[model samples]
Target chain A: MTASGTPASTGPASVPHLDVDPFDMAFFADPYPTHQRLREAGPVVYLDRWNVYGVARYAEVHAVLNDPATFCSSRGVGLSDFKKETPWRPPSLILEADPPAHTRTRAVLSKVLSPTVMKQVRDRFAAAAEERVDALLDQRSFDAITDLAEAYPLSIFPDALGLKPEGREHLIPYASVVFNAFGPPNELRQQAIARSSPHQAYVAEQCQRDNLAPGGFGACIHAQADAGAITATEAPLLVRSLLSAGLDTTVNGIGAAVYCLARFPEQWQRLRDDLTLARNAFEEAVRFESPVQTFFRTTTREVELSGATIGEGEKVLMFLAAANRDPRRWDQPDSYDITRRTSGHVGFGSGIHMCVGQLVARLEGEVMLTALARRIARIEITGEPKRRFNNTLRGLDSLPVTITPA
Target chain B: MPAITFIHPDGKSEHVETSGGESVMQAATRHGLDGILAECGGNAMCATCHVYVDESWLARLPAVAGDEDALLDGTAAERLPNSRLSCQINITPELDGLVLKLPERQV
Candidate 1:
């Protein structure tokens, strides 16, 4: 039955309700158990605190993402309905937009970040990875998050985006604001906005065409605008989209891969045995520990999802991380096996709105892990790993680890 | 049902039948066929599902344009005259006997 026709007994009142605050700090630390509960609860559950519908199972999440016409992004991929509330900043052109507006901007960004462009930057990225690994291996032990994960992306990405390096540290806290603003106005969200306010101007300035270096991704975006593909006004917003969405995700993704290999020594052994598995290992890590977790989509109209009827304009939270671990779709879903075929995993999401910068992220992960795998024989956890708390991103703040040279 | 033959890098071939309208990438992935990544989920954004159409059947497919044309240049395998992103080629009755040669690697 179509959602337009209300299925008896599947009304809002009958929907399974969860009392848990998904944005709570405790929940962010270990979301797996809660994810399990959400998956088991039902396909569409009511989050009483937020008054939003949540879809956790793989089939349901996949269905919601694929049917973009129903579960649209233009209304804002967060708690705030763009149709009702004014966005804190200008809404993202690509991330928060539906087609054909998304189509034009996406075409410009995708071509700019195309694999051909990635190939040109590869050697530079590889050298950076090697040098970073050399320095870290010399230490033998260090916090992987600060020293490796966060350090590696920060070293290459900003320069690649063609931003001036002076105020580059603003990228992370700024990313925290971008992702956190997607959740309810909790302490984390407020703190992120406050902490990042100081550096917002620097970020905005970097997105300008004149500020970007020639031949870099940012410059390429502006070039597209000059070519009439995208407008001059749309160009900087696209560049800003890159700055806001790009950095922190890659940092967290790299961190997740390292943390996974350290925790799963056997997986590390497999990667060490075949350094070529570095790319696949990184892909598996993304699937195992999805960094960009839940993204909310507002329903364009009434929709019947997994037997539940969702009203028009209702908020539907898609648990992408939870879907990655849904057993209904994957065998031994919780295990981190690098050899596993993780192609279909929603680590970078699915459908038209899938992560546009994934190729870049993969290259970053591949080179870093490949360099480490070639030189480091073992990755041992040296101390307690401190998890970084963000409303949408899941990763470590500090992951202490000791590496043994091969 | 239209049958699609997938020729692996090793020359091993497998035929999968599916209803019309889904892209070849969708059919290949659904049947768990080897070597079709469809990494960007059939958006023509990623060229991981690159395949070489059988020489005789190349003309049956639609002319590649836009994103598909751009991404094809960066496929892991050498881009042949018959090279196409499988995601752009929709399954149809005319493609019932279509044959696609899979690339050696899709990264």
Candidate 2:
């Protein structure tokens, strides 16, 4: 399409448009080849399938994320604009919010998940990792996704949130549905919405202040409301934010780390050589496998980016997975080297909207990898890996691996 | 451009020049100086970019506000009265020759 609202003062330029559906299952299965083409197409390319602008290159994506005022997050971080279409659930106080409201909620959540609190949970999380690794050593082969990736977070995260034991099974489904809903109104989104009632009910019930056990993250959030830091009405929504954002992301993140290590034996060896590299190894996996792949930002006004002028109120789909692997930003962008400098990767996103629960995720990843690094001599892929296709997340459904004890 | 000095825990110092509007953490990381991780990329969410503003220059720097205040409590280094997240301090003409002491470690 011709650049529609170009001002007379600026030179006429055609916006690069592509015939691709990013939300399609085929594209989700292997997005990198398409991602490379998108990156090469331009800094900003219009996706004809979704009728939205797509940003694939690192420089543009980083700039868009950083300038939240210009490319706002409030209008639903998905295809459906919150202003135009009603949200399926109450908007997340922090994730879907901009400043002022966001600043207040973020302060409370950040305090709850601060480094000091992480320090307190460190020993207990480490003990849990050690216990799980001890049990896994007995099995010759196992599904990393089910046994290690899913099981570890399922065990620890809920307890940390003080969620009751009975309805814990709904956490993953709830998170999966929440993440999938971020995409278009495709079958995946429809099916997830249709099946989301029970999971939604359970998550909402668990988020209540009375339902949560004392001296936990959930309780801490409610306490923040009690102390006048946030309103009582906002407390449960913040907990809902955590439940929605936390579990499945970490599960896939751990799965991605294990899958990457299993594929790259040399990188695994490096971690084994220097146990200190456990954190770096997990981080590199995040950079290489960017699990929470894409997020949408709405342009607050007419914007000029990469010589294309995007009209006001247009949705710009950020290819976070593509940016993480963009050759312009990363050296050997496709390789899974554990020792690479992974600090700025947008896997956890960037700017003020960066993942609030990242420290918790990092602690989990580092602890699990360290536990395995200490005992496992090698990680061998024994069977075909099953891919879990989703609109927003890139992860595995099952990864069969056999571990050798050191 | 404003010149800034980053003094490591060992007392060794590195001097760098940064353009206006960039944060001290941005300058350090851009110059490839060690210690300031800036994990949150200047959002002040992570305290890995903690630094102790040199006593002489502390009063001149802008006061800490918002997330930077809460995050200072979580720094790997001890939070001194003069402590700051380098990401919060923007470089300017008046702040030339700013001195910042790097912490012992940044986790």
Candidate 3:
């Protein structure tokens, strides 16, 4: 069941077919069942409506992600291929580019976000997280998503990026459109783009060198431009990459962490028993919830995966969230265990183009969860959690939680 | 406890007291060192945790696996003859006092 070049079904037309419109509204609401059906269908499932082939099992999805050259991203990591159709926004300098371009942009970004540079902001982030936790706990009962997850990243991340604080409110709506647009011109995407239209300018404006506060990550990206690492034009786009990527992913991740801890009280008690589990808890929640669910990759050549030989330029939809929970790769795949070694999960993706801001995400998750665990004795979900609908990102819109103070 | 020496990009050496069953990347991060990006959290994905093992100790380590080798080709720094991803290198007592040079950058 590993990522073999052979398909479960022989020949291309005989490819295991599933009529699931992955971008449909209902599928986004609860993807797990569809995920299960897709995985069980075959290693490679053909979606007729979109005319895209999908790999849902861990082995096949992992293979698609790892073999980026064969399953390229340069064409566009979305349903809209860059060559044939216009992208909603400028393609990511990091996420959507390949090889030579990706190599340079990634180098500059990694250098800007290198662990050493990140450590400088740790104390500041930890302090903000601690303050947010204490303030939220005073309320005792609040919507975890809005009051905590959304509130925290918005407050700290923008300031850290050296963005002008006045228009920072736009990050979330803008993020929704950006992530949603990856699926298709679906209702969710079209609606989000219209809703976020006013605020989209704020995102691009925040990346301007003149708009950035001195000596922040944004400024560093500009500095790289000065150093000839990236062009002056690529600088702002790279900055856009950071804000669009770093913000919502962390928020959903934090949301998932809080949601998971509340649902799994024993795991919460484990965190209370040992604060050191904070980082691992966040990672497990990522594996369990998989905030960013799916990304499309294009075939560079006639590639044989599972048992079908997919032709060149064919889009391969990689179900990352499904892969993380694949039964073949993990034991008790659906269970959330803070202590489980979450290595090899495609939650942050794999290969050359893995999440560059993941260190920041982990730091944010660790600080916030640690501060909460140290003060909160128990996390009880006060009401049923409501699902947040997004084309690609999976998260809770509202998680009512009542925390008992330690 | 077996010891591992991590030669940082800035040439500051932090000889960590380590144990078996943890990655060298984990050893560095666990001790709060400046090297090793480990962006995918040691999923053998990002080559940001690239390190160059001293030739003497290179033979003691496990040979690079296919995925790890494929990723090594994309390291920001030139792929040295001794280059390997620290995440792929597990700690073992037999290789106590092992040393790995951190690259200037491992994007």
Candidate 4:
């Protein structure tokens, strides 16, 4: 579509073009290898097929995330042409916006989801996490991903957001589609779209203020609208942001942390010995294995990064996962070490648009992991783990683990 | 342990003894000082725990980096020149008797 042979627009000569085959199963199974290759090949690789420039290195990725003026989010962060596809529902008022609009929406939601306000739900979330872990540990053997990790967030986040129990079943699959839609339309997107159709109405209904529980975050958002902090029209879209971002991300993060601990029993022992490491352990896990792999930003103008040029309006995929592991930034990047004072990691993203729900996510991980470490003597993998297929979310399908109680 | 005083927006001052290794925000949080809310658990991601250091003791604190500076722009209240995210400031003996003015709101 452009002079650089990428689908979007003409990029400068230094930008290396990479044509990513959306259908590649190996790429799907393990994208890290491809990410590594892209990182090594060049700092800015323009994918001709996907019509996007890929920034795999840490510095460039960080730069793109920080400089929102140069790399805008308004053209739609997802691969879909929002003008054409127009989204089955409205775009996320938070995620899909560029500044000024994003600034206002984020300011409103930030207050609603503030840590002080969130503290009200902290004990409830911790108790729920403890209960879920207790139930799973009682079974002795369970799929860590589905039973503990996924179950905990699904049980806690939705109820906290005030979605009805029956209608709430659609949250995960719907969220999976929303994340997958960030990438190119492939079999994965097709599959998710096919699966999500049945629950579309249920999902839409939950976004309405009337459907939200009184005093929950969703209701608070509508209240903010009523108070003129945000427009009434933006209320459901904000609720959609919470629903879309809240659960699956935390599920993957918690699962990844547990998987890392199980793989490294020494780390598990350390956590068991001192439960305070539970918080840092999650941060370390995110640093080691980032759950949200990549998010694309459309370059607003020609920007120079890592001795290369990224053209205007070109989709730049910031490989946060690869960046977290880049040897340029980290020492012993691959090891799962909880004590490794891991701050500044891009797992929750970077710059102004980082994950707003990260506090809640950290609380969930800390509570459950602390509970597990306190009660369980050891965690061992009883069977091979299964990986969930999503273009964006790097998560587990099943992680069979045996918990030996202390 | 290091001693630190937090000056609330209401001009109320509270002093608390904090462990050397704990972040100022954490010490305030552990003491249940109504002000500092370290939302991201001291990852320096969120700017909830905003405070203005007493100008005389400002030079004693570490220089604010670009990241912290950018986050300060998002603070809930009007940010003073010495505005710092309390999470980024760890408790040290050098910071003993350090006075910080808490903002009216974290969000």
Candidate 5:
């Protein structure tokens, strides 16, 4: 055993075991059961075939996320250890590094993504959300995911990041692959890799300084590099961070919000009654059905968890969705309640590496939620919602709904 | 009111009255002390509020947690061993004479 009491073996028998396969259909259809099983199994449960330790309990997940020194991010946050294989394109400059290096790069990008600067594009985002929702309202029967959720972000985020219209098509598939790559190289990763090839060049081209719009965040990151705050090479990857995180997460978040509101009509009416509740509704949805399901971190040293020992260099997967539903942290954990205080949940993650683009996400949700509250008197699912398959993110492929006009 | 001194990047010191319950970042921002930006709103998500704790007060302050230390890795300014996010440092009677050196920039 190592100093902290974790077994030093790299073999299958050394790690604590778990029963759930994250990519399985049942877990995908409803992950809470698997979450409960993992949490009940142990604080750090190892999956034999996947060869990773999983942390499903709320407290353990929180601890792992906050203690990056013990559980580092440099080995690539994905399931395939970066040390063993090179990443397909390149690792996200922001998501792939630990501090000192991560700090300098994050600083440059944060300035470009500052709340004041993001405010500049808020109205355009709101208008785009309204236009898309209105187009669906005219039909009165549309897939909430394809028609509204995907349509809205696809319309706004890329343009805001300074990509041209033709390049917009590549946004979703590329981002899906990136997030999927964070998981084991299962059928999901294979499928995403196959579909994502066509858009790689367009995504890479948009990373160039000349290709970005003059005043957008992407160009601004390059400007910071020019000013000696960051290197020119770091600029594109930082822009890629925005592109990679911007689209899929928000789309799933918004989709989750719609699913919750429709599932609980009383909550939708509450939002309609007071527009301020729009923000609360969106945030609560994140707490209710976390979009980015799970992310991994490598233990830098032997660390003691609730009852298990996580060895040095061992991988730990934090189930954000499971943690969000953890009974230890929330009252009636399964119920979707907007009024409940949810700000502390790890939906956007916790600790230093928490989502930098959260404000951008909130702004997007607020705009869409407000527009729907204003235009639609009531909404209910007309058909069973279809789930979009991904190893790490839970999103809708289609949510057919009937919209009653306000 | 306890007076907290913030030594700016330019070597200027600004004193502000801080409430017992508020964090150092909250007090500085509330009093318009320049050079500190708590961008994540004190959630420890962003390292914008980084400051070097004065050596005199280091022994009195609680040790930084593993999570906070990990976050300190990504600050724009070079991190000294005494570095802490001002948001995590709450003011109290024991910390009345606390002093922090503000970094040159907040990303």
Candidate 6:
């Protein structure tokens, strides 16, 4: 029974309806107010226009992400339900799948991304990070988004994937389009589609074994196919999965940290005192300003959370950014304190389908932030940071920053 | 500080000082004892921190509850009788010399 004593299985007519357009520019730029409204509206609020259910509270969003069997991600974790509409492209081998298929694919990807493998790649990442930091520090004034956040990942991740440097510019827009397409086909989605075709072709061509370097993540995934862990055709799609989900999140995450540090310079000072705090600082920033903010999960069966009941196959939106700052789950939620034990914040998500490349993302963050802390004594925002909106991802369009060398 | 030993998939082991309140996964990550991803950063959500508790230390730790039990099913390595998510096991005085054998990989 709900706190309000509403029957758990009440139909759409009796449900509390919210008419907010979460995809609009206003909501995308500043969503906390709407998120608060959604959370206060009820545990389960019906979005009348979208014909979907929305949950912004931490407990509800975390619970839904964990109980994948009840709230399925296989049907597409986007506004459009995969069951009702045909997929725009072949679904991600890992992201858009469920067990036992998910089980097999996840096992393969996880092992490939496990710490054992990730360790060998770190020193290389750190060295590149230090080099990038030195360059940025020398310049002192640069757009953190394009100069570092975008440039760093674009250079390193593709090299790690054994992607040829030629046509590498496609990674950012390719990922942007992929993430943007997750929402309704609004102007943003339409624009992304128009800009994405060439980049998508480059990514597709790069996924082939001969096109990839022999020892990269792409080739490692193909080796699994040779071992009969997955099919030959499935190999390229898995590489495509890494390209789609990995790079953009890391770019935005680093961007978020730069933005956070610029806003909260004291946190940056704490990092200067102790460089070990890089990963912790990054984790806290993710908690404070989540990059991949929201995802949709389709209900597999009738379910009641808090008070609202959602029927099977209906889209349920989980506001991850909202969950990260839910006052019920956090103390002084808006403040970004590096000391906060920010793990389990749903920033990298939770449960079976968590971000497969989170470790890599954290590694990138640690490298960049730690490198900066070692050299830069202070940070100043030379101009206002601009917001880049997508249906699911939160990132900066550009952040102009000037650093003072230690 | 009480120290813990982490054994990687290749059977390599390293001992690192473990803080009283931190989880075993934190000790490993802090000291750069690779193989423990702790991807969710010690959150019970990701089973990447899965390890086989030393038979001697198994019963001394708290019984697995919550999401740890379910997440075990997602590990890339085979789940054994002494299997546990290290993140669920907080370091303490009684468990000073905790030994955890990380799986071949965490799914």
Model 4 residue A403 distance off true place after TM-score fit, in angstroms: 1.2
Ranking by lDDT: 1, 2, 3, 6, 5, 4
Could you give candidate 6's per-residue lDDT for residues A115-226 as a string of tens digits? 5566689899999998998889779999999999998887789988888778887888889989988887788887987877798899999999998898899889999999
lDDT by residue (B2-42, candidate 5, tens digit) is 78888987888988889878888889877866677665557
lDDT of 1: 0.89
TM-score of each: 0.96, 0.94, 0.83, 0.81, 0.81, 0.83
Question: Residue by residue across A1-406, what tens digits does model 3's lDDT show?
Answer: 2386545544457678888988886887778899999999999989988889999999998888888889999999988889888777778999999998898998888777765665688899999999998798789999999999999998899888998868777888888888988887878888887787677788888889999988899999999999999999999999999888889999999999998898889999999999978988998999999999999999988878876788888888999999999999888998999987676688888878888888789889989999999999988888988888888899988999888999
lDDT, residue A139, candidate 1: 96
Off by over 4 Å in 5: A1-16, B1-41, B44-91, B95-107
Q: Which stretches of candidate 3 lie over 4 Å from their true place?
A: A1-11, B1-85, B88-107
C-alpha RMSD in Å of predicted model 3 compared with the true structure: 7.4
**Residues B7-103 of candidate 1: C-alpha lDDT, one tens digit per residue:** 9999999998877678898898888887987767776677999999999999988899877889988888888899999889988888889999999
lDDT minimum window of 10 residues, candidate 2 chain A = A5-14
Docking class of 6: incorrect
What is the CAPRI rating of model 3's predicted complex?
A: incorrect
Candidate 4: tens digits of C-alpha lDDT, residues A1-406? 5665664433545566666753356776777677778888887887777776788788888888888898877777777656446775577788888888898898777777665665578789888877986797679998998888888898888878887777677888878988887878788877777777765667778989989999888999999988998988889889888888898899999999999999999999899888867987988887787889888877777767776766666777788998988888777887999887465578888777888888788878888888888888988899988888887888889999888888
Better of 1 and 4 by DockQ: 1
Report DockQ per prediction, comma-separated: 0.59, 0.55, 0.13, 0.09, 0.09, 0.16
Q: Candidate 1 has which clashing residue pairs, if any? A: none
Model 4, runs deviating above 4 Å: A1-12, A19-23, A83-85, B1-55, B58-107
Tens-digit per-residue lDDT, A27-70, candidate 2 = 98888899999999988888888889999999999999999988
Single out the weakest 10-residue window by summed lDDT for candidate 4 chain B. B37-46
Interface CA root-mean-square deviation for model 4: 6.1
Task: Give fnat for candidates 1, 2 and onward, in order.
Answer: 0.47, 0.44, 0.11, 0.00, 0.08, 0.17
